[model samples]
Target: MFTTVKELTEQSVKSGLPLSEIMIRSEMDTTQKSRDEIYHRMEKNLEVMEKAVDRGIHEQVRSHSGLTGGDARRLQTYLKSGRSLSGDTLLQAVSMAMATNEVNAAMGIICATPTAGSAGVVPGTLFGLRKRMQPTHDQMVRFLFTAGAFGFIVANNASIAGAAGGCQAEVGSATGMAAAATVELAGGSPEQSADAMAIALGNMLGLVCDPVAGLVEVPCVKRNAIGASTAIVAADIALAGIKSKIPCDEVIDAMYQVGRLMPAALRETAMGGLADTRTGRELKQRIFGGRAQNPAVEEK
Candidate 1:
């Protein structure tokens, strides 16, 4: 029944329920599944995320194109050294987010928060919050439900597909979801959670899905890491009582419009942006050996 951020927020604020609970109740009502069943399913997803993060950091995961890998391990190593410019917690989340995408690039199994391209943000922030807040397993699971709630709104109202929209819809929506869930995990109000989403997504406007060499390596992995940081900061801002002047739904609408207006080259066609740079093209030619598969653009 809660198809919009406004409706979900009103339901949560009026009923004195957390956004997670609102999402759970909606799941129960629509699917006729008991609360425990839904929670169990979500718990399985959490386990998958945990496994991906662990494996990504533990093992040297390399992509087929050999474009991304080992960066997560390097960051984790720096975090352990205590010499990182960013604190351990932020670096941990960033590393974990990079970890997930590293696994994805290596063709490992990953739970897409909304899309596989933006898979890292939600779990990265949740596990990062765990480092600082020490949330219990139940709290972490509920955090996912909260993320799912916002993700649901984004998928329904806007777009979560890189081809349909861009990286803004993929990573942008995931970052917004993580921000809202982070607000709830930090005990912020549902309204504040909405503001967190708005701020996070607003910061991500106009992001394009221009994968170098038409592969989800290069900038894609790093972007996921940055998305996690952006989500965390956006949550902090919302918890600190900052509000986005534009409403969440309207921001989503604007994103959709921007996506619609985006040049086809920017929407995962890999024919524009960083994908077309001299080094980007060189990297593509190096990796795929002139076999980079960007069907949208005819190869010369």
Candidate 2:
């Protein structure tokens, strides 16, 4: 168990192994499972993610509340038109990210890379990379392992639950994980992967988790799209030899501290931030028939 990015990178350097292999070995040791077993397990998860991404892109998946749907298809259609100002890869990532979350919102199956709310970023970047990088199947699986390694560190040292640490913990951690994994998949060094994680996470620090109507549809789906875009950019920056002055572990710690200081209303309580706005309250009332006020605090 590498507890921090520094330890993870140091071990990877000392052993001349990719971060994915280290995580695989660690999982084997911890679970007393064979390497093939663990790899196959993660492969199953990859399949689920692939299916969700495909379904979302091809179908108009709408949530029960009808808060979010069809946007992924809209983006894909826009991509097909080739009139986008943003680059194809970035827009593709954003589309896929929204697709996965849209599927999740519609109660479709999705493999949570860290959490279901932030599941899209990893596979979003992975498929986006497929366009140009053309990584093999095994390499794709390793990409997920690399992501899981960083996610493990965040879940253990900081938090991966939005209820505990806000959107910064959920989507922010997933973005960092995806950024590091993206660097590794692109053949960057372990140090470069660490830099990507730090840079990506720093960009998302202190993000609130104020889902409108106590649902994960409104901002959550779009946040995943932005997170994917950020992860790709961060990975490119790291691959370009740009390093974050704040180390990866320290950035994660800072995320933890910020989450700790964040008000409860911003930490998945759905009583503040966008969730507390006049329009947000109106949406809540419409959704729940005017009984959606925070249970612990009566609305004046």
Residue-wise C-alpha lDDT for candidate 2, range 117-214, written one tens digit per residue: 99999999898778888899999999999999999999999999999999999999999999999999999999999999999999999999999988
CA RMSD of each candidate after superposition: 2.9, 3.2
lDDT of 1 by residue, 159-253 (tens): 99999899999999999999999999899999999999999999999999999988888688999998999999999999999999999999999
Tell me the lDDT of model 1 at 107: 93
Clashing pairs for model 1 are: none
Candidate 1 colliding pairs, count: 0
On lDDT, the candidate that comes out on top is 2
- Name the 10 consecutive residues with the lowest summed lDDT in model 2: 290-299
What Cα-based lDDT does every candidate model obtain?
Answer: 0.92, 0.94
List the pairs of residues colliding in candidate 2.
none
Which ranges in model 1 have alpha carbons more than 4 Å from their true place? 290-300
